[model samples]
Target chain A: MSAPRPVYDPSWDRANPNEVRRSIRERGYTGYTAGLAPGFVQANICILPKDWAEDFLLFCQRNPKPCPLLTRSDVGDPSLPALSDNIDIRTDVPRYQIFRNGEFTEEVTDIRSHWRDDLVTFAFGCSFSFEEALQDDGIPLRFLANNNVAGVYVSTMPTEAAGPFEAPLIVTMRSFTPQNAIRAIQITSRFPNVHGAPVHIGDPAQIGVDLAKRYQNVGDPTVGEGEIPVFWACGLTPQFAVMKAKPPFCITHAPSSMLVTDLRNSSLAVM
Target chain B: MSAPRPVYDPSWDRANPNEVRRSIRERGYTGYTAGLAPGFVQANICILPKDWAEDFLLFCQRNPKPCPLLTRSDVGDPSLPALSDNIDIRTDVPRYQIFRNGEFTEEVTDIRSHWRDDLVTFAFGCSFSFEEALQDDGIPLRFLANNNVAGVYVSTMPTEAAGPFEAPLIVTMRSFTPQNAIRAIQITSRFPNVHGAPVHIGDPAQIGVDLAKRYQNVGDPTVGEGEIPVFWACGLTPQFAVMKAKPPFCITHAPSSMLVTDLRNSSLAVM
Candidate 1:
């Protein structure tokens, strides 16, 4: 890997999605984009070649909770006009992960050098939007306070297969008191595009998870006293499917590095 | 005390609330009224002397989940115009339970002979409204199929009290698979007037329920192997408070002998 590059610029602290994209496209901002352009929607980026886009789209359609498609770019197109006016699929995202034959190839700040005419970009809604909604409603999320994402677990449950894209269901768990858990469910149910509510709650073992171990060690899974763990369909689920499918080529946003969009989080609420 | 008086007339089968009330008013129907007047709202009745009405009203307001007031009659007025047209509260309900000094005295088909000029009547939203919604959404309610109501339990949690009313919160339990339990919460959340959503789910012991021993033996509480017990605040909660208050005189609907009203159950959905 090349030397680590700064991912954030303080000048873009309160920048809007367009402003953030300008900095990312100019190669000034290349780090994780978790808090940048707050109140706007940030999406998980997945760019599959046109040959594989059909199967991936079908896969996403079948498993909407994990892969809720926000917008899909036409073949050979680099811009997602629906999400942002100038969202260049190759440069708007801070960091991108490249894979070849289901194997990790390398990470790059800009995919301009690797851009292909056959590339088709698909943006899926991420949990950040709903998490912001929860916090706005006075629901405290422990992981956010601890500067971590939700802990992920690969459940034994299988996802419906489309072509070779099949893998165990991936889940992310957050702990909350029973009362807050109910409130969280109600709040998240409003934003169906962003995973929408929880897939499982209460017993972790019931979903084939051991509380002590998480797939990526992304967040704290302590599940403190009087708190129950609620699991949501994770955005990483599609990435897992790509790895299992062993497509000739695949591209995705690196962990915590997302494509900030012009869409307001509030607009995503179905209610 | 008195040998059972027939509560339903065959002619009243599939009748509207007004039709059913007409037969009930003539003292020809005096049995349980469940499964009658299918689409209309049926309420749990509570009648108190004017002096005790204020405190009971406050209690119901403070504990809305349990004592959701559908409508309360004006003092000494036999008509509940808000619930139905040309209806008389004193004679509308199928059977009335008479209490003296907070102790059950007897059951009567009508309360005209015992009515005092200062009497006040309160009608609370019952689970039947939301249960109908649940069944309409294709959620199978096992207890309903068995001709029973939900199992009842008195939780150790104390309810907010008013002047002379203070008692433990009473809950009703229903069993559903995890998937259906989540759907149940969503469906019921729409009808706030009729106990919305569930207060607790999963382990019954977490809420002080043994499952093996229901409070009144009202229904089958046996949770199937994969089903979990979900508990909702019961309308009977206020009756428990009345039992503690020991008012000079009180009248309530006999079990399953509700006051059928002209209000359509669909009208209660806040959404």
Candidate 2:
């Protein structure tokens, strides 16, 4: 009836980026891609009609912390050769969210039937790369250990507006003990493409964030005693901007469903 | 009459390290060395009998964050060739503190009268190097702007003991706005030869520090609102260890009256 919900194969966790993409394309392994292809970069995806693409590009360029552009597909093309060879944007992503007039309309495993010649695909750097770097440096991430996501908040800080694209800055909050928090800042500062260093630390109220009040309750909304809450510009800010713009038609990879690339996470590190 | 208190030469602010040493050695510029020879290294000086030198060396090795040993001179040698070709330990430092049997006995401009064949001189890295790095990175330091020193605290954390050389870890605390604090951490991490990364952040009591109760009222103890206090291991920790060890006779650079060296601060950055 419902095109059987995408199933996850545990073996996919150890698969290489190409094999993982092949599974999503040919074997129907169309589930959330977190923890798959461990060392590769996973990008946030946004597809919009060519007319709205220019403004979005300016939006990303102006607010790079929240929307670091990894690569963009040529208008009307389904392949992003810069991200990976043999990549078919229409089907390589595990799941897609369809929007009409900026209202999320439906969820689909593959976007082939919805593809149009006027569409452009934008790939953005995701925090997963830096998170991996932090973990590799031996800094423990509590959310990852608890199987929870970082808390999300809508901060009073506003993003620079570009044409129809404008929204309040969105941030993802993570709590760390003081020493690890300092280490996290140093480690993340190395990967500027993947959100870089935190935008704020200590009192969330300074940034107009109430720890108890999270945006959409998307994560573990708790800040334990003795832990410092650190906030970073989130990729979701662009999604919020797109929602506000209400473009006639748009598409994005569903949450946790990223576009995997051949690029190594270390390759994005400036140092 | 006591030797005339050294006078400040504003021009020395731009003088080379060797010139600064010459002024200290022959021209009587024996005062606090802060803000002199801006781009060069200023070391904390310690001289002890050879019997006490080995234990102090082990103490520095075990507590590197607090006592980063830059170079040590051969016993009976008055010159530290590694720090500067012209460095005479007895006269290069602006002022020296003499400790006799575990107590401060007096302060002097020249330690030549106090020098001995059995005496060994140890030069340690100081925070001035990393502070310069932070300021160069455009992070404003409030204490420096106010013409005040960083707050000093004796924490509950203890140093790894080396014979009789052990004391509570001492830290220098600097407060900054959250964003600047993060930048400070990133910049300081590049210079591990100095104090390197911060040892603590956030609540001071967690490390047994009561901001109001500073060590000897050494600095401005205020932690302003909207600011985060970042603490780094301090060179004073070794002085504290020396006091506890109660070496029969010891010599050290007077507070803020450091030994100016030919080494550039940039040479200390690992990155």
Candidate 3:
């Protein structure tokens, strides 16, 4: 007998986090998880062989603002029960990017073939979690409207190195009126696990960022009249460190494809 | 017979807040209250006749960022028990500025001779309180080092008008490295009774400020290399509002001559 075909359900957008993960695990949903399971935590997933896990963990600890480590799975364990009840690291994320010695190898729907007894999974809080917080506080995020809410820049600021991991800090910029910028700082400050407060504000040039020059243009780059740019530590920072570390084997969620978990975003607030 | 002369002891600087008030009240100490009662709350005093009290109260409510009213004495009452024990508003402050119909009339060592049955005392939290908090957190105030830690500027931003009270907001500028500036905002935000967070940061021109031309210069005007100017709503703002309001009679503490209270500065932290 042939296996039944997986059906994509539009209602999944409004479904619970568990349902969203179920669809992704079953191969029914393979798209970016940006707005899915709103209010729940979406994580940036990074997997490495057991030999390189300790150094990567130390890297995150040393450079917490950019790589806020939320939880890590037991060595050789594929489950992150601390984050959710039914997480299977090999199949939960919608898409995975495979890297071999710092070079992009391929993308895959699931990592069952890559799962092994010598692997460790590390999950870090993503900036997407704090965007919900900023929005809830009435701070407007431009990328929400124009589909490009931020301009990515590699700051001259160097990350504190741990073991072999070292890289320039990557920041994502969002412009707001000075008034709203203060509110943004206050709101994001409550969620340190998700980047926590701005790393720097005002004078992008001080951080070696040229507003007109963006490393990746995923959002509108315009700083509106009377609006000042506020920059936050981006989750891409660890991926950069990983690239420079050149681990023998690594797995991460494809850019924009995150691990949607049952944990609520508000639960991440330190306050 | 002549009254006994009060002893002058240099150790009064380390004395308790109430002792400092006693020294000032007894004429043993009649100098600026800065660096005295180091950890206590120092207040900005505004005494108005009962007829003008209501309007001034409304003015404070309308412009809380600049006029964070901490306590108010009942009409005809000279005591501010809310701020300390044995508190007599007429004698606690070191010096008084008598204003008649919005014009400066005279300065006095004590207000007992000027105290009246119709007088109402309003004590607002002073920036001196938050300066302590900032210093405790290791954010340096330049004015503290050179005895010119701040520059007072009259900004183009207008206060919310209440009754006859309305004037351009008065801001105090303090320069810091961009990093320490963010820390200053976070630390000051904890004491809303004080000015709270800064009203404006960066680009003094945006707020109609010319650093070289301060309304009153108490500190260096230089914005050093790699340093940005941060402006906080000054206690002087309410004094400016009172000046414009033009009440029939009002009394305020002389510049830098403040009321030292028993309340600890740390007690004012909201978080």
True contacts kept of each: 0.09, 0.86, 0.20
TM-score of chain A, cand. 3: 0.94
Model 2: per-residue Cα lDDT over B30-136, one tens digit each: 77788778899999999999999999999999999999999998999998988888999998887888999889999988988888999999999999999999888
Q: Among these predicted structures, which one has the highest TM-score?
A: 2
Clashing pairs in 2: none
Ranking by DockQ: 2, 3, 1
User: Which whole-number lDDT from 0 to 100 does residue B216 have in model 2?
Assistant: 89
The residue-by-residue lDDT of candidate 3 on B80-139, one tens digit each, is 999986888888877788999999998887888888999999999988888888888888
Supply the DockQ value of model 3. Answer: 0.52
Using all chains and alpha carbons, the TM-scores for the candidates as numbered come to 0.94, 0.95, 0.95
**lDDT value, residue B114 of candidate 2:** 85
Residue B137 of model 1 has an lDDT of: 93
What docking grade does candidate 1 earn? Answer: acceptable
Write the number of the candidate with greater lDDT, choosing between 1 and 2.
2
What overall lDDT goes with each candidate model?
0.86, 0.89, 0.85
Tens digits of per-residue lDDT for model 1, B112-220: 9998889999999999999999999999898888877899999876689999998788999898876677778888888889998788877677778888888867677
Please identify model 3 stretches exceeding 4 Å from their true place: A1-8, A11-15, A216-218, B1-8, B11-13, B217-219
Candidate 2 chain A lDDT trough over 10 residues, lowest sum? A1-10
TM-score of chain A of each: 0.95, 0.95, 0.94
Instruction: Please tell me which predicted candidate would have the highest lDDT against the true structure.
Output: 2
